[model samples]
Target chain A: MTETVEGLSINLATVRQQWGFAEAVEGCLRHGIHAIAPWRDQIAAIGLDQAARIVREEGLQVTGLCRGGFFPASDAAGRRAAIDDNRRAVEEAAALRADCLVLVVGGLPAGSRDIAGARAMVVEGIAAVLPDAVAAGVPLAIEPLHPMYAADRACVNTLSQALDICDALDPPQTGALGVALDVYHCWWDPELEAQALRAGPKRLMAHHICDWLVPTRDMLTDRGMMGDGVIDLPAIRRMVEAGGFSGPQEVEIFSAEHWWKKPGDEVLATCVERFRTVC
Target chain B: MTETVEGLSINLATVRQQWGFAEAVEGCLRHGIHAIAPWRDQIAAIGLDQAARIVREEGLQVTGLCRGGFFPASDAAGRRAAIDDNRRAVEEAAALRADCLVLVVGGLPAGSRDIAGARAMVVEGIAAVLPDAVAAGVPLAIEPLHPMYAADRACVNTLSQALDICDALDPPQTGALGVALDVYHCWWDPELEAQALRAGPKRLMAHHICDWLVPTRDMLTDRGMMGDGVIDLPAIRRMVEAGGFSGPQEVEIFSAEHWWKKPGDEVLATCVERFRTVC
Candidate 1:
């Protein structure tokens, strides 16, 4: 493990299988990794108060909360429920003093096939929660998932697409909206460097890093650790820097087979090592 | 079957496992399928002469050849080999009088991280072979694979990207260069409709259709049949048709688990049924 890991954050989901919120906080703290992001389920699993106490007591920087966006639905009631849930997520981000609420804008709803409609729902959903997020002082970061996930995970599948929403919802480069650029989700984008540069500082809220495996066995998990796969991390980092984003490069991996099965401390240690050398 | 599909073409890949080239052709013929797009490997297996003779004897409109590009390489020598191979593919396409020789432009070369560089090689490779293809009266249809294949199978992963290559190689709107727009590869693209509009008439060489399974078990082999997954096929077909591509919607399923295991006759029957009803 690296002796120092400044400017790097460990998103708890990277080692989610081995550790819960509190345990992950302790594990990262043991590895000199303070900044972290937790999913709502993780927070809920440990109770918000305890999770907050860990953050407060350890003086860990909450890079961003894992999520709060599944905007598309089949009907008005479903939309209302999504918005209400987003509001709760906004409150959670506020409570945790998170850098932003990372929004995995959802894909087409069940029994529906209109991607444009799902995208419209995402825009409306983000707009519905913008004021609350602004009031809570928690920025919203729309994480454009990879196109493979477009049908089920997120319809907004490109950085340019996310920026379009950011533009539509918050026109003046308002601080309340931005993007969480995850390399695993978007490393293959030809316009990635350009889009990241277009994001600029105000809109580039978070940067996530993980390698894309060549034979990605599973669509959702099976993410490779840094340096173990094909992504040119430093090149993307150069693009991010050129784009004017100089924030924590959070290590957010979902390796259901490899890292998830390792010991939490070992996983944290490897993340530290990879972030220092590869990411 | 709803009995409305007279123009649907069954790409032999949809039922690759159930039959060899001749068998698939016979099966398609039995079901009144007058069109097919056989993979180069399958054609080679039956001997190109036999395949071409069958096409001539039966008078089939081979909508498009299955493939002819994997241009990226670590060195110039390898690239030259790719060009030479493409020339051979062009000849085969000519032999079969296929509408176009589809190009799945290559991804990064082995141990290489520069996708942009790899893409440059693809463009250059295409430029080198464009003359031969044009001379043979075989249109070169650049078929962009999904982004998941960007690292290994294809770096050209969007219709816009493919169209960009076509425009660069054939700026005069020449009929020799065009795109084989596959809904499975490009359905997630936000600029899909606009790109289709951009690729009007002569530039739109072919249209490939297959559903993106909700859980695509294998990234390369688990493609679903039309109407079986999340893609809105009729909508994309509408856009392509509006763009002046009156080509048959070619079925190109690669489902190792499902379709590949089905009887070729049943699969062709299913394709005809889906073509009339769902597609």
Candidate 2:
């Protein structure tokens, strides 16, 4: 009989402070979590070859690679370098057999106030990488980060905006480009449900799960666990499912003060419990 | 000869830490700023009658009232109380002959995770008060706060969203139901220019100015002065002006640690200087 952890994927960042790539894989196995999304740095620490070996041997599912975007740069050379790096990211995701390569398309360039210009650079950068991504058989998932990160993190801050990019690039919903919809980033949007429906299964490449704490202390690392915050995880899940995405809900918390300090086992166990209950 | 501070208004909250309503007015005058926006608490501290007297005597242009909208409530009684409070706010704005009454619509009620419900409550709440607002001749400016405040402060987080509400309530683009376009709250919106154009002069009740700091220390307070951060203020001003709003750009910085600690004169002087230059 094949043992499978259905509908749950632990994003390695959830226990980043407590475990390395190998340790996290082991921890997830112990908790019966058979799927995961991992950051590039985590893959590098274990070596891409070793990570791929582990995934293959254990029959583990790589939900999505953490990222490959940050395309905005002040100079052409810098922008070219970003595109080159993104191509490498595509190779890694292809190696891991990831569902998609998640893209956190970058925010404003240094000393630049032209957000529209920055956004244009993101689209151009993504287009440059799309051919490489398609050739590698790795779908690119544009993760629309929370608007608060619009200044320093990602310029693409809405599902509607991400879909617009996908339509611009792919045009035919070819599954070559899609969006990684995280509840934390998108739950507050009034058009979220409509956008999710518009994305459907074809464009909804990944479904990331996390909560938005009421008094979110740190913008970068204060994300809440499944049931701890204001986000209605089950409701968001329903919307994604209605949109035809029946994939594992990836748990991607970046809690610097709380979850990061806990034991890796404890974190995995909590995620499993929440996945079964609240999520 | 009559003197007017053209294209400038000091939201008293900028100098709130150092001056009360009366003193803030004096400080603005000292800096040659004739227009001002004051919070309800500041007006209460000096008595509304007294505040009105000062506004009348000094020939001050009351640009806007600080706030008047916290409509979401778990129970009908609580919601009713909010509506009553909003009515009082309308009366206060009327008494002061202010340009508009800015509404920071409430977020989710306690222990509630339904943002959609909260949003519905916001529209209903606004609709409930529209009659009172119209009766008092006090235009209600629905200020779409940043998405960071969507969970606690305001659910309306986009110009498009706010305009949708305005269209729902008053489809004819009446000046009574409009929006206060604050750069600090809305500078990141993808459709800002389009929405500004949609708002035009009639729906653009007020124009607010401030900057967004990159590594924002606090979600509530750490707003930057005009030139201190990444927002393209002059570009935004041009958009607003193109939309036909040529009102004084109200400077509303909520920098608790920085501007709040400065002397009132210095804060006002800085506001004037930045307003003239960066803004």
Candidate 3:
């Protein structure tokens, strides 16, 4: 449980290019990884029933469904539509029996600079969809992205900010609303340890790991694999564990130029090796 | 004073490619800009004595000396060497009679993964030079770079973290240490307004203005002109004002592809125009 790869989970984005939903599962299974976090596209590729069947048949643990938050919009109608889409995503996460639906709560609307407004919309959208998520028995995991993604990808860009939202929406420290703490997005933060401690075990829903490359080529897809970059993985892993979240350290690299270019087996093999040694 | 260009200052890096020290000073003067911040290289190019003479003769108000901190280093000798260089930079800043010596406190050292250790080095390095800075009567302005630069640029990535250092080093609010708050580096922060309030008048040494472009091209360079990007300039200016600092809002853009390509006069003209209108 403490910086051990025994609980390693692959957030399928790590080897997304080399394998589809079923194929990726096989790859994880081959590497003795029983836990995975798959994106919506992967679920859609193979029908929802088939994806669910695979989960049941293989007895694999779906750590999280990636993801379900783009709440901000230009207007009320658009906002309503986003909430509806989020509800469907919650349903899908439920079908997949995902532990939580990770929310990459979106950034500013197109041609808009009102980040506060966007953030409010994110809160409202999440609140609007909270009922559906609760009814479906699917916990919501707010995944605060890297601040670089603050403009276009996600408004929630810190563990503190995500935990604030969770506190507002589900103040009881219920497992209903929590945070997916990704070291790649948060290792630079000075307040990270304090925020992780504040989140504790109950609100600490998922633990994602990836390295932040020094000369990060592309903002969205240039994530480094474990031990490949500058993140103090063991340090963050220790912090997460101390926070009392004994969840799997989900490897979620989005390295389009590097890891994605490798074969699925090679990627999984490397992940396993790194999981044992570095992470 | 209220988001007006009447107190506008331009950092020379905005048009570094277009002009040398003397030429840039002449260009700024021609645009009715009486204030500027020049980098060390620019000062070194034209002898420091000549540069200081030019500054005095033109009656130019230097808002800040363009940077004096890259403190983190691999070993004791390396760190000691950095502290010595910073002492020299403090001397230069005092020679220029600048308001503050802006410190872009360094990131992780070469082949190092200890961000906490790097941060400790930053603190120790700053503490090492604090007495010299005080003697020189040059306040050390900690310019917390954007988080994206945390690995290779600067570890101090938040106003709060910088302020903590300030509190630790200069607890009496002696104005010996403070922050150069840049909109481009900090616009995405949710705690910006609150932290600005915390900085108040004494610790807010310099106000830097630039825009955060939607697709920030290069992490180091692709900065936008004030009106060209998505920052809420007026709102931040107001927050800074409310925090008790009514200093000149310095224009500092690092647009390698766009603004840097323009003529010095043209860049100065546009900065003047944008300063009056948008910033």
Candidate 4:
């Protein structure tokens, strides 16, 4: 299929506040959207079997599980906990038959100034959980967040850095590990297009779509809708397609005060419209 | 002269809310510190010629001017106005016998999200004014801001990006253009040490120091003083020194609520104390 983005999926975080998992899924189906990426919390709320059954019954493609990262901590015990959680997440992805488990590699450890050290912890944590993920047949996709999140959110904040970690851990360029390229996080990077090309096929995993809002009000939540913001979507999509990534451009807006307040059906319809026209 | 931090200067914007330029100078002199950097507004308020004379009379070194960036705008007239104002800033730097004109390359033009294009505009803006700066012996210090400011502040957000621009414009690695490596901006980067090393002596125009607060309250203004936040100053300073940068670590905090409320002399004294112990 040429994939004109009409077949594009929406990550339910785009309308998280308006609907629970079941409601959001129903909303997607109502709008002729048949694929989605759901956050872990959403899956838990709907129950794993039900969520999985919904997918099988409706033939909805589970593009990716919302997360399976945050792999950094102050101590071994905390890191082990993260790893354990990641294992569970991988199992969930397997149950849902998700395309991949997206990872948001964590930021600095508590009371620590060493970002490099935190990064090391992330690597070690991922290595600890890699076997479990591989056993579950769930692909792990490291999502590089915006650099602003380096302190509190995820330190893997560039496509190059995330790909570097993937290369380090999966040296033979195995399909087990890859990167989830999000346009909002990397739209400003000068080496972005080059890095996307470097990602190639085996290492290119999931693609998330959102726009970077100018004068962003909240550091964490104020994400603009696809066409409303300044990202050249077609331009980035072209780069990804050239890299042979034909997956969904999952609409993963973290807009707490905007889209979250709209009707779920309305939000899904808008996402579909934007995906067809702008994305 | 083995330039220990005893020779390191403090840019009072780090503490300007706490002190005027005159008071800051007096305080630095009290601490046996003889070098400082001041913002343009401070000079305007205290009178520019008088600010120049104070530096001459007190034998204080003005390491570099605080700023002269903000290149992107909604329209050509606005951009032209910014460039014209930048030319004036270069003149002011020359007048003060400052070492360089620090440029915080501006972010997206209003209502636009093309960061690559914004970066292009920055290079063009600098090229437009480079001749005047060169003629006046004022090197342009490209201060790559933290990525958090990519939307409203400077879009040049990494040492490598800044160095790339410098390479493009000043291919010979001349003293005409370089970078102001603030530890806060580049600390999270895995490539920081290498990039700083790559910057080398000639291209290392300025070295601004401040701690990266963990919470980082407000995106624009909430900077922490040395030892009060999480960045390992001595480690980065080691990298800069290893890279052959022999300039003073100019303290440049932008704490709107904290240091801004303290007495001018107290803030200067704290800066000196922090410089001795932490920086």
Candidate of highest DockQ: 2
CAPRI tier of model 1 = high
Candidate 1 residue-wise lDDT, B128-162, digit = tens = 99999999999999998899999999999998998
User: Considering TM-score, which of the candidate structures 3 and 4 is the better prediction for this target?
Assistant: 3
Q: Please, what are the lDDT tens digits per residue for candidate 3 over residues A1-279?
A: 223236989999898899999999988888889999999999999999999999999898899999899999899998999999999999999999999999999988998989999999999999999988999999999999888889999989999999999999999987899999999899999989999999999889999998989799988889998999999899999999899998799999998888899999999899899988998
Q: Chain A of candidate 2: what's the TM-score?
A: 0.98
Question: Under CAPRI classification, how is model 2 graded?
Answer: high
lDDT preference between candidates 2 and 4, better one: 2
**Judged by DockQ cut-offs, is candidate 3 incorrect, acceptable, medium or high?**
medium
lDDT of 2 by residue, A32-127 (tens): 889999999999999999999999998999999989999999999999999999999999999999999999999999999989999999999999
- List the candidate 2 regions with Cα displacement exceeding 4 Å: A1-3, B1-4
Across A1-279, the per-residue lDDT of candidate 4 in tens digits comes to: 222335578898888898888888887877777789999999999899999999889888988998888878888889989999999999999999999999988888788877788889889988888888889888899999888888888988899999888888999887999998988888877788899999998878888898877667787888988888878889999999898898777888988888888888777778888888888
Count of backbone clashes, every candidate in sequence: 0, 0, 0, 2
Q: Each candidate's lDDT (Cα)?
A: 0.91, 0.93, 0.92, 0.86
Off by over 4 Å in 3: A1-5, B1-5
For each candidate, what TM-score against the reference?
Answer: 0.98, 0.98, 0.97, 0.95
Write out the backbone clash pairs for model 4. B14-B253, B18-B264
The TM-score of the first chain in every model comes to: 0.98, 0.98, 0.97, 0.96
Candidate 1 deviant stretches above 4 angstroms: A1-4, B1-5
lDDT by residue (tens digit), candidate 4, B1-279: 323236578887876766788987887787777888889998888988999999999777899997899999888998899899999999999989999999988988887867777888899899999989999999999999887788778989999999999999999987899999988888777789899899999999888888877777787778898998878898999999999988788888888888888887777778878888987
Candidate 1 chain B — worst ten consecutive residues by lDDT sum?
B1-10
lDDT of candidate 2 over B42-155, digit per residue (tens): 999999999999999999899999799999999999999999999999999999999999999999999999889999999999999999999999999999999999989999
| Two-way TM-score contest, 1 vs 4, winner | 1
Winner on DockQ between 1 and 3 is 1
* The 10-residue segment with the lowest total lDDT in model 3 chain A: A1-10
